[model samples]
Target: MTLDRRTFLGTAAVATLAAPMVRAQGKPKVVVIGGGAGGATAARYIAKDSDGAIDVTLVEPTRKYYTCFFSNLYIGGFRDLASIGHTYGTLASDYGINVVHDWAVGVDRDAMTVTLTGGDTLPYDKLILSPGIDFVDGAVPGWDITAQNAMPHAYKAGSQSELLKAQVEAMPEGGLYAMVAPPNPYRCPPGPYERISMVAHVLKQTNPSAKILIVDPKQSFSKQALFEEGWQKHYGGMVERIGPDFGGANVSVNPDEMTVDIDGAVEKVDVCNVIPAMKAGRIAELAGVTDGNWAPVNASDMSTKADPDVYVLGDASAQGDMPKSGFSANSQAKVCANAVRGALTGSRVFPAKYANTCWSLIDENDGVKVGATYEATPDKIAKVDGFISQTGEDADLRKATYEESVGWYAGITADMFG
Candidate 1:
């Protein structure tokens, strides 16, 4: 169901609405860093639910947001580039939010202020950071952001996705395409496999003889059986995956030579996609909330372990059991929003529960999904129940799953932006 912001804010039976509004200071300012699923959802929900009782500001450098979730479909020729782009107009005008297009450079916990690139300081009663993932420096030998034009990671989902698709389309007949997959605990666990499926779909229709190779660090991956089955059925003999046991762990690349070295064996490729090990975005580190690569958070409300007034969400948060997916971020945002509002406006705080589902398309009308419900524990967000799509599903069921994903995309974007 679509979250009608007006109705939810007006008549959600919030216990605090009956009493006089009480804020920590003034309207209880909430400053959110980043504008992806988690940040956007958090900002919108806090502003809309408070009904002018809270002042919310969202910090995002980009004027338009392109979702990483369905970007692979665009690469596969299932969607166009403009279809995935969204604007913050609605969040600003309709939700009564201050949407600032500026980079957040620093966070001073002592003063409870965020410094922007434009030299403006924003104060916050509660701060939410959802800055997404950034690749570890030098994680992939011979590959870095400077070589992105030649070898695109396209994980952040914007111009990089367009560049990757262009490179794929421009590949010569029978050209080789290679991918260096990331290790565990990365954003979108099934993303790389889904990307492979999309790439295979494109090559099958465009360059039938083109070869695809995957150099993976992990021996096993999310939905491994389902993906392997689909590859065998749809693109037999066209794709080859080398796992760590087969020297996938010992690999390097040269963008200039278009070569991949796998255990001292070199293979030349026309295009390369290198997904390196990731960490929380720079702002999270600047906030001093990160423990090495990611910021640990209290699962019940996404509050940072280092600071109670601050929250971390989405890929940057080391919340347990949730596989850094957009659905997980959106769910976590709701729980966070509730907690923040309760703290600011004395609302009824409900028990924290979260849920997430990830869907991957293997082919046209062929989709698989994994989903779970979770609860907050002393240690982490522990899984309560879960299910996954099996390999050998009927065509109708797969089609239904795919259709369900389409609906979810619509529902979630609306929930986040509106």
Candidate 2:
């Protein structure tokens, strides 16, 4: 069940091993759960490359998928909510993919079937699970999913994004906006910080007296220096960050009272964005592929260590050295799709190569990025090279970085849905 680089690359030899064919024409079936960056891209690639040789079905509950990558920009008024939303119609018409809008409730490994909440079961020769994330219970005391309305995480985007923005706008003058940041290994390391900057931008323009506070568990964060510099330059005296050195780790929120308890000290806030500890989406656990938290996946093909027939991608997977970003998921999906297609058919499987870049916008036309290229090794996905934006960079380079992110957003969405 443990697939090393050699075993994963040799998947073609096992192409003819799948049995109990479901289709009358003997076409192999692939059931993909979750329709975000990883799942959408994987389903698209497999269907596009197979050319009617395989049956690909993608199961996602949402009709219009709102990407988390640019949701921050939406909050900052740089982009509208509609600009970040996408539909699967083009993925269905152009690519010949079956996009099912429903929840995948269970997985039957022995029978090779996936059960939906609607009482229909889909049989598959290969299964891909890319469910993004769910917050851990009790990670933030006195806070849970039920309190999301009061303390909007807005981590998942869409309605939550709308709710959080509305709350920020409704805050009283000189009111405090607090954010309880997540721990290490969470999705989008710089995401919460970028959101802070966006919120700062809004407050500076509207409620100039409003204060922004970040309660972080980690000692350091991604692009820390860049974000700090931007905060000081753009919204001086409006932003504050408290790391673990100042009791940021021991924190809890009272949604009813709209107060935060940091190390036994209570501070009342107008709006609280509690991004608690996270794990693979519930479906991943229900599928019985997770190692308590995240599903361990092979570096070469993204197949889970629990079962080679099942693959985990994006935020649900625990592949070494790759931050869970939209770009990471897109990169992992291509590698997975290629390997899956090669395993189901006699198609050529290329060597696995992966890369990810996470871009964060501090203010208008001020962007920073961190990324690395990876290779499949016997141990894990090894980082080959990396880069990041430096402090004190000229405005032109920063603006160009922001523009590059704009182009990438269009390119990736087109690549996913088309």
Candidate 3:
């Protein structure tokens, strides 16, 4: 159940072995579930800062991850998949962290162990759960895994991204592409809008006559004015947005007929991207770490209210005022890592300052960003000062911002897994 650094590294060839092993000396066993933005960064930071004081094991099924941050560029044909995809080999070889390719099935709080899908249980002194978000099934009728094959939601930023791109490429010049945006408190508030913009950018190039319809459950969205301005100036008459007043045009899709019903009206589209309601990843729910859909955590440490030794971060945790984005996840990871280290080492935990910046691309050459920093209060997350891109900014500035966003992606990916 317990794996030491040497045994774990040595058993790389026979990872399936379940032999009993002696525990390492002067090290706290830390098992991190999920290897996306939050889990990867937390594992690397803990391994680096702990300095042989803690054993870090990262449990994730995927060896490589395609980030959602700049995936819009991929949709717009501005970037290749290789540019966004990252591997965990660097985290293993360079950071001295045990990277386990396994899905966490359950958590036994009484035994302080995590059960894997392979029927193996790994004991840990502390656990970090950053399993991210999972789409809510039945949130939209007639839309499930099978339905997603035709109408892809590239929210996970991998195969789904490729599928959505393929649909866009195959669409006729005058075809319609429909995207249904989820309600607030979901992963990546501006993400759905950014996706629409990117799709429009592609349409401008390949299918100039193509039209985009955005169906949203909410009245307003993050960076609404900026997105609207960019859409009007660049893709006018091609893009249309319908809010709740327009009949709650956000819910339900019929993937078979490629039709989506908004309120009472039915609209046919060439392609549909349904971003359904979301919840913390399945493992969090299995472990009883979530209330309804989100894991309740202390903002200062991101430790779950239900469990003291387990911390949840990223989209899985209820981080008030922090939109579920890669920037926020990475920021939360660092804070949680420090808190876990302090708790294990009997050191004082300092007040945490969290920051996030989300960049949305209107075109390959144009981008807008919204950023903010916050301190956790008793009731809610209060934002500090930050600014969106200035309205009607010069074209050159927008181009510069797009380039800056690419750099940010590279830097953050390196910070997370490198």
Model 2, runs deviating above 4 Å: 1-25
Each prediction's whole-model lDDT (CA)? 0.92, 0.90, 0.84
Model 2 residue pairs with clashes: none
Residues 1-418 of candidate 3: C-alpha lDDT, one tens digit per residue? 1223333223221111122223446578999999988999999878876665678999999888898888878988889988899999998998899999989999998899999989888999889999988988787777887777888878888899999999999998799999888877788888998888989988898899999988888889999999999999989899998888887644677777888888868998999998888999999998888998999888788888999999999999986888899988888888888888777765445677788888889876788889898888775456877778987999988988877777677677777887
- In model 3, where do residues sit more than 4 Å from their true spots? 1-26
Q: In terms of TM-score, how similar is model 3 to the real structure?
A: 0.92
Instruction: Provide the clashing-pair count of each candidate structure.
Output: 0, 0, 0
Cα distance off (Å), candidate 3, residue 42: 0.4
State the lDDT at 44 in candidate 3.
88
Best by lDDT: 1
Lowest summed lDDT across 10 adjacent residues in model 2 is found at 12-21
Best by TM-score: 1
The digit string of per-residue lDDT tens for model 2 on 1-418 reads 2223344233312222222323456899999999999999999888877776788999999999999999999999999999999999988898888889999999989999999999999999999999999889999998999999999999998999999999998999999999999998899999999999999999999999999999999999999999999999999999998889998999999999999999998999999999999999988899899988899999999999999999999999999999999989988998999889888786777788898889999999999999899999987888999999999999999988998888778777877887
Ranking of all candidate structures by their TM-score, best first: 1, 2, 3
